[model samples]
Target: MKDVSGLLERTAQSQGAQPRCPLTGTLMTRGLTVPMDWRRPVTSRERQIWWNADHSFGQIHPRPALDEIPEFYDFPTYYTHDDPNSLDSAEEERRIGALGRLLGSIAYRFERGAEPTVEWWGSVIPRGARNGLEIGCGNGDRMKTFGAHVEATVGIEPDQRAAAVAREKGLEVHAGTAEDLPPAIRARKYDAIVFSHVLEHTMDPILALQNARDLLTDTGILSVEVPNNASTGSRWMGERWRWLDTPRHLNFFTPDSLRACAQSAGLTVRAVLFRGYVRQFMPDWILDEARITAAQQRRAVTQADIDRQVRHSARLLAATAMAAPEKKYDSVRLICTR
Candidate 1:
């Protein structure tokens, strides 16, 4: 593991005085202006077709090819929530499907080779907590894990299919967004609320936090994990950064900005730890870029091609680990108290 304490101190010292939003008093950071057709719904059928065509191995969907979309200083990191083109269930399914396909492919590669290990943010959950809620809980793997410790665990997932899977696992899951959480659930308080890799998708992170706060006990903890926009990998990959899943990942945050957003929502930051090295993403990036190159040349991408790329990626990861063991990580895990 990297020296988390040292990284935290350096991040604080480098950020200096944190900037706040004028209206909401939220911490402000640079925003990307990538205009998305939030109204454009990519259906499950569409995603299936794309995957069947092997597009999942490459850029399955077109994205804005710019460094920064345009910067806006505001409370809501994203502005198109209420727009006619904003995301809906069908559209969200499409987005999730694409992501699932990409992750599945990565898993396939890992199963065949030296699988990369990640220190899951789920470990932040307090052992003594009795009950907890996971916002945007996906298929509820984390909820299942938490349920083992906590007496009762509830999950709020937007994907119906995924929710079904969670229910089959005997998890208490509700199908919907946090904004529209069931009143029965909303009335209950939790010892901890988890927002693992979910906040970046929200248009109003502050509001999301505020809603989460309402569901937590006075002393409850909010554990959040998000991709670090200011990571070395982000800078190195530029537009091709795998984490830059535009439209889906609307808000890019640094530790300072994330703390600002959490504080604005009536939460006190307890700790901000930059966690997990992303040696795998480097190879994923190379493969994605290579696919584009191959497409332009009217060449077919083969399994041999993918195997070669994966081998190269493994070598690159080894080199980076050997040379710079203390390199900056690609994600930030924040623990906040209400």
Candidate 2:
């Protein structure tokens, strides 16, 4: 509701080493310094995290240059960047592991929410819509899963390798970030835009939302999901939180901060929803992330070790299973309109 034009003018400061809070227009202070990357153990550069005290908004300190950003996602092990179709049954089993392959159905049912990942966006997509767009569509799995609800869907990805993989499946995927829309995509307004897990990675999330507004039809829907800094898992795990996913994630948001961000982008905030599994509900999830960090402290965990972890996870079911997560959930979803 307040004037954000002056705020936008100041975002030029982002070009410097420090970044201003996109929602409040305040310069952020230091939060903590991340030493090792759990997922990418080879990474040794220690990066600092900065945050705004009042609002739960944060950014990676000593900002990475735009050119250097692409290299961060170049690794082959990043799951989201992997090509799903390329995984043969053997490879899939290897990735999921022996215990997972054995108890696959049971574990999946017990852990997966009633709603599929695509349902989060599909449930809100306007009925009778003809076209939609997804930023950071990954391997196009989300699009293929939810495309039936809409006539057609396209995607934009910053990773050229991941974008090419999606394109191979006869999808309309353009390789680029939302901050810079290719001329081919900038030409048309989309009926709906799904910006899941992509905003925080952008150099400027507020600017990205504003650009999405320009691409959206007046009646279009924009659904966004980001890691919730206030989530219980985030608190329990601290720097070890799986979602923290530093280096790859350039920004962090809490419930209030996310709402203000949408409103700040000259858009109307329709609803705010918090949803995701926590360690209380999924004990194995923590062990899974712990293994990544633990591998560094000692030898790599073997299949036998994973099997023991799976058994331990099953034992934790009764004591851990109480109620679903509410405010303590892992993600914050914002439904908005132009």
Candidate 3:
């Protein structure tokens, strides 16, 4: 196999130019197009195709229902779950969570100058506060942080297995898609709703947001995080940028696209800010391709490659942060209100 590190460097180095908005003809704020190479085009045959072709593994885009949304026909998957970049199994996923907590702790100490509260699950808890809903509450990491303050904390997840794990961890999780939210959840109201890296997967993102809105109590807050379409990493990394897990992520959003969708869903884009995370996994992205290409076939990435990717990503992320203005590049965390 090829040297994973070298491949990663090339992958990250390849697409150096920035991308522009397909709709507006202006430079996209993040490289939203990088995931396209992994995605298949949308068609009536997609559902059938999904079932036939590695449905358990690869990302698959469903044709957008014609009545509500236009057929975006072209977009990319945001992440992959199998051969190319499979993380450890469910039993081992805890280490990834541990890494997340460690990162959050570091950021809180150095940047926030205060202990970061796990308030996402409790952001709306009423002690005269509001209730909160967490969408795609993977493993309850954010929810665990929120357990203290909210009057109510609920999470909606589509994966049954993941939901079971979250429940075991003491989080109130519902096993259902954003489109098919349990009716019990749909009937309640919340004070805050969160969509963290979860919106890109839905076929009808606007409708999903609208559904979230419907569950909110009066004067609710909606918070979200999405990979920035114009970031330098994406512009340079192209298809190998980890965020572009194609087929699974059907839509890409710029600030303009986001605002448009939020407005249509009866939500107002109140605040949008760029946030940075360690670019550690990036080197692995390139290395995976090189390993497969060199082997002349599909295969799994090695642990050594993953370790190197993390180290490289960390240094790059720090360098990018120090070198760029906060506004000039980064993924976005948008805060909205209704």
lDDT on C-alpha atoms for all candidate structures: 0.53, 0.69, 0.51
Ranking by lDDT: 2, 1, 3
lDDT by residue for model 3 (1-338), tens = 11123323432432345432222334333322222322332232222112111111111323333332222322222221112234434432343334432443443322311112564334433355456788877666676665466666889877555566678888788866565577767767877777877887665566677778777666777777666655666545545555654544555555556666677778878776655443323233434433322222223446554444445444445555444433234356667776
Full-model lDDT, candidate 2: 0.69
Candidate 2 deviant stretches above 4 angstroms: 1-19, 83-122, 278-284, 295-326
Predicted candidate 2 versus true structure: per-residue lDDT over 221-304, tens digit per residue? 888888888765566456656787778888888887777778888879987776564333343453455564455454575656
Candidate 2 worst ten-residue window by lDDT: 1-10
CA error at residue 181 for candidate 1, angstroms: 2.1
What local lDDT does model 2 show for residue 57? 79
Query: Which has the better TM-score: candidate 1, or candidate 3?
Result: 3
> Residue 178, candidate 1: how far off, in angstroms?
2.5
**Alpha-carbon runs more than 4 Å astray in model 1:** 1-127, 278-327
**The best candidate in terms of lDDT:** 2
Error of 3 at 298 (Å): 4.4
**Per-candidate RMSD vs. true structure?**
13.7, 5.0, 12.7
